[model samples]
Target: MVVRIFGISIVVTVISLVVAYLYGGVEALILCAILGIFEVSLSFDNAVINATVLRRMSEFWQKMFLTIGILIAVFGMRLVFPLAVVWITAGLNPVKALDVALNPPADGGEFFPDGSPSYETALTAAHPQIASFGGMFLMMLFLNFIFSQREITWLSWLERPLGRAGKLDQLAVVVASISLIVAAEFLTDEANRSTVLLAGLLGIVTYIAVDGLGSMFEVDEDDIDEAAASSGGGPSQLAVVTGKAGFFLFLYLEVLDASFSFDGVIGAFAITSDPIIIALGLGFIGAMFVRSITIFLVRKGTLDDYVYLEHGAHWAIGALAVILLVSLKWHVNEIITGLIGVVLIAAAFISSLVRNKRLAPEADAEVEKSTPVS
Candidate 1:
């Protein structure tokens, strides 16, 4: 498996290099490598969650995710998303925006010559919007996890009386939409407010629509059990359920990844405006790392060993979501957003290790008791 994985990586690397060479030579290669490292380091949490999900997927879907999913991530989110933002905000034609990104205006010691702003300046300029997007996105993810994990008791209706409404999802959608509209109306300069509002609405609406669609297609646990019993296999009914569960898991993983990439892609304006570079560099490298991490988690059964890693990643994602929302009003640095996630997850991992160590003696004693005295 290691050899196969390495071989696959080599093929991917060679292909990426060839594309980079044709497009921007050494510059593209260097950028891709850097972005790859950045994405991998910041997204370790993503891998853990992805592993948990991937393990549940059918082999067919797993292959699809590895192939089609990678393309969507690389081209759709990383490349097109940023260019779309520029086009929407700056009113630049898509082709021209692509050109400007590829060949930015000369630097005048103030900003890029094509009237494009510097990385820091652009990030500062758009900071509020980025924050709002990230914050709300993460918050929704956090809430979803919390609600899902809670024990649902049919008779315990003490907390909030609206449980029978079946409208929490709708409420979420409406609130997010109104929030964006209101923010656009009052929170920003007239020229830029429309852009920010539209972006926020886009994120919220997109998430809701996608999630809803996924739910519609989801196979229930009972259904999975029936299917498994019908076919008598060593994997068992529970295994089938877990495999089907992977689909939703993969969907959530993709959504989470998309949310994380939003800021990073926007942040790339700080490095270069060329959409090609942003797409080629960040997209290629980031996708590769995501894949590598996914494979690692799947193979090592890391989730079984460290139960809290997913919790930590989700929490980090939640923090990011909140940061994005707050950023709508106040500027938050992407570097800071990335760092906060890394630190939180790293702390969780260390804590998990410590807990495991402390439990070692107890676990060993239990094993000894179960064994015949020798």
Candidate 2:
């Protein structure tokens, strides 16, 4: 599985480079590789979380994740989403925006010769908006992690109550909505309040819709474990339910992937505005790494061994949420976001090692007692 995953990553990277070369030649290839590494480093936690969810999914869904899901990730979210945001906020025509993105200014001085805006300039001009999107998006993701970890199942019980209040309690949607309104009041120099509001609404709505779909489609964890135990290394009953279960799992995975990508995608604006470059570079490479990491975790059963890893990732995600919320009121650097996640996960990993070390002696003693002759 590791070898296969590596092969897949190589194939995807080569294909991305080929596609980029056809579009923008050597420059695109170089940009893709660089951004890909940056994205991968920043999103290792994303892979871990993905593995947890993916393991619960059916094999068919896993295949879908690699297929149609990748298209949505690469084209729809990474490419079109950012471009759409720029267009809506900056008031640039979509075609013109694409043109400018494709052909950046010569010296980064002037993007357009006819006094029209350049892609770089447009991207710079849209920094606050992108920041706003990322800030709110990350906050939502962090909140969701907190909600998930708590004993309280908000969706299971409070779903109807929250619905009764005629309001959305999902943190991401709320933050995005509030950010849109705030940006409307203070940052309306570019996009209309409605556009920002629409964007926020879309983020929230997509999350809820996807989440609901996931709930309906998810498999019972107890059932899977029981089947696995009974099968005893043979094909488990999970294989039988793989089709429908896998589809739902795949959908959930994609949604989670999108949530993780939000900050990175918006941050890419800080580097460059070529949608193709952003999509091919970040999208292809990032997704490939995510896939490889997921396979590694699943095969190794790392989650079972390092339970704290998930806890740490969730806490880091929570911190990221707060950072996103604060970003609404201030200028929060993207590097800070990435750093916080790294620190949280690193701490968790170290703690896990410490815990294992402390328990090793007791475990060895118990093993010696069990082996009487030995």
User: Of the candidates shown, which would achieve the greatest TM-score relative to the real structure?
Assistant: 1
Off by over 4 Å in 2: 14-29, 87-94, 105-116, 121-138, 147-205, 221-245, 365-374
Q: Which lDDT values do the candidates have, in the order given?
A: 0.65, 0.68
lDDT of 1 by residue, 115-171 (tens): 664333433465556555655565555555544423432213531243343335555
Q: List the residue pairs that clash in candidate 2.
A: 139-321
What TM-score should be assigned to candidate 2?
A: 0.73
- How much lDDT does candidate 2 score? 0.68
For candidate 2, the per-residue lDDT at 340 reads 84
> What would the per-residue lDDT of candidate 2 be over residues 136-157, giving only the tens digit for each residue?
4545555565444343222335
